[model samples]
Target: MKNSSAADSVVLGPRPQYPIESVDNALRILLLLGERSELRLTEVAEYLGVASSTAHRLLAMLHYRGFIRQDRRSKAYVPGTALTGVAFSILQQFDVRQTLRPFLEELRDETGETVHVATLDGTTVRFIDAIESPRAVRVASRLGRSMPANCTSTGKAMLASLSTERLHQLYPEEELPGLTEHSIRSRAALEREIAGIRRRGYATSSEESEEGVSSVSVAFPAEHSALRLSFNTAMPVSRVKRADIKRIAELMRSTVDRAAALLH
Candidate 1:
């Protein structure tokens, strides 16, 4: 994921000579939440390298301060109003979402399927924007959600653009975390898939990230663009067929080409 907890987020400056442990730990949790939309107490503990009791205390303080709020059922800590307000302000400073939203809307209109514009964050892919399909029985929007890159077409599309050395740095281990039985489970398997995506110039997923959700994704071209995002169209499993893929891939590729032109 985009976790410093996992990916060592750039710290920007030398370590402080007189660091306060509690304050540092609290900031680390916030950083992790920036990469992940939700976190659990156990995950917080492991990420911070702290005891369960200590992690709980930090989470309680943040929850009290309204930086985070626990889900009613899941009990996972999610961004609260205060944190979201800050994030919204930061997003305004970077106009990627504003720039690509129209392409997402047009793709949804053309395909009558859910469309998303997502960017890779370390080993994760975060859905930054989305447009829902008009159909009553369509895949739902995954806006603001993050998942393993190898498991999603959006993530794979972006990952395939990375150099081989970069790919190794991201997946140093042979074993990979799987969301479902169909997810790519080994680094070898993932590498093969990445190679295929590079040749195909697009990517596809069939219930790998989530059951009943299959998608086609084309990474926005890098030409004249620094933004690394993908154009994705998702549909229910029953609605997807082999014949549907070539058509969807063509639309995804053309749409991304047009969106990429706007970056200049």
Candidate 2:
């Protein structure tokens, strides 16, 4: 008679069977590395319920394939350069709007104001995602809109990350367009504002992008190739008092840092 345990192992329904055990194990190791910064061979073996020798072989194969690297002194395995390259490629293919929607929504709920994610496209910053405030009186959504790099807080945040030579290349004209009287109107003034933004590690716009909207933004570090991104929260000038700018900016920076960590 067939063993009852063997009978239980066989599925009677439409459940798919994972036939490649080795590939499944390797994929699990990759996921484990992605979630953790480093792991020792013993820890890996214990976690995977495998013998030390088997764990070593798996790790050796992974190291050979450039998915992980062993530290010279600690012997702990960390993500390798190849893994980073693959991660960057995946991020390039991923939709920014979908990735940032939850974060932007949280920010909007936290501040009761509009939140946006934007990226630099040549001399302009384009809004790729936005979460509108629930308040009756709130800033209008700027989704699918583009603004001059020197006019908006999100734009300025991205602009602050660029080299001076790159900035000059983008804005060769002496005078720049202003959305309002508050917007930076000259290259020298815009450069000065960018210097301040770099020093502060965030950017702010006071009725510069629009007549009454004020915003604070922070730029994400370029950990992924060709991805220059920033996020911002905007509120009406009446709602954001002069004294509240610093506090709001700090909060925005904290949120952006969290988002950056998740993406990284």
RMSD of each: 10.3, 13.2
* CA displacement after TM-score superposition, residue 85 of candidate 2 (Å): 22
lDDT of 2 by residue, 115-151 (tens): 8888766567778778898999999899888899889
Provide TM-scores for the models. 0.66, 0.63
Residue pairs with backbone overlap in model 2: none
lDDT of 1 by residue, 1-264 (tens): 222354256488899999999998888888777656578999888877888999999999999988898876557787776776566445536887898888888888889999988876668787888899999999989988989999999988998887776576667779998899999989899889999999999999999999999999999765445346788999999999898898989988888888788876
Angstrom error at residue 2, model 2: 63
Alpha-carbon runs more than 4 Å astray in model 2: 1-93
Task: Assess candidate 1 and give its lDDT.
Answer: 0.83
Candidate 2 matches the true fold with a TM-score of 0.63
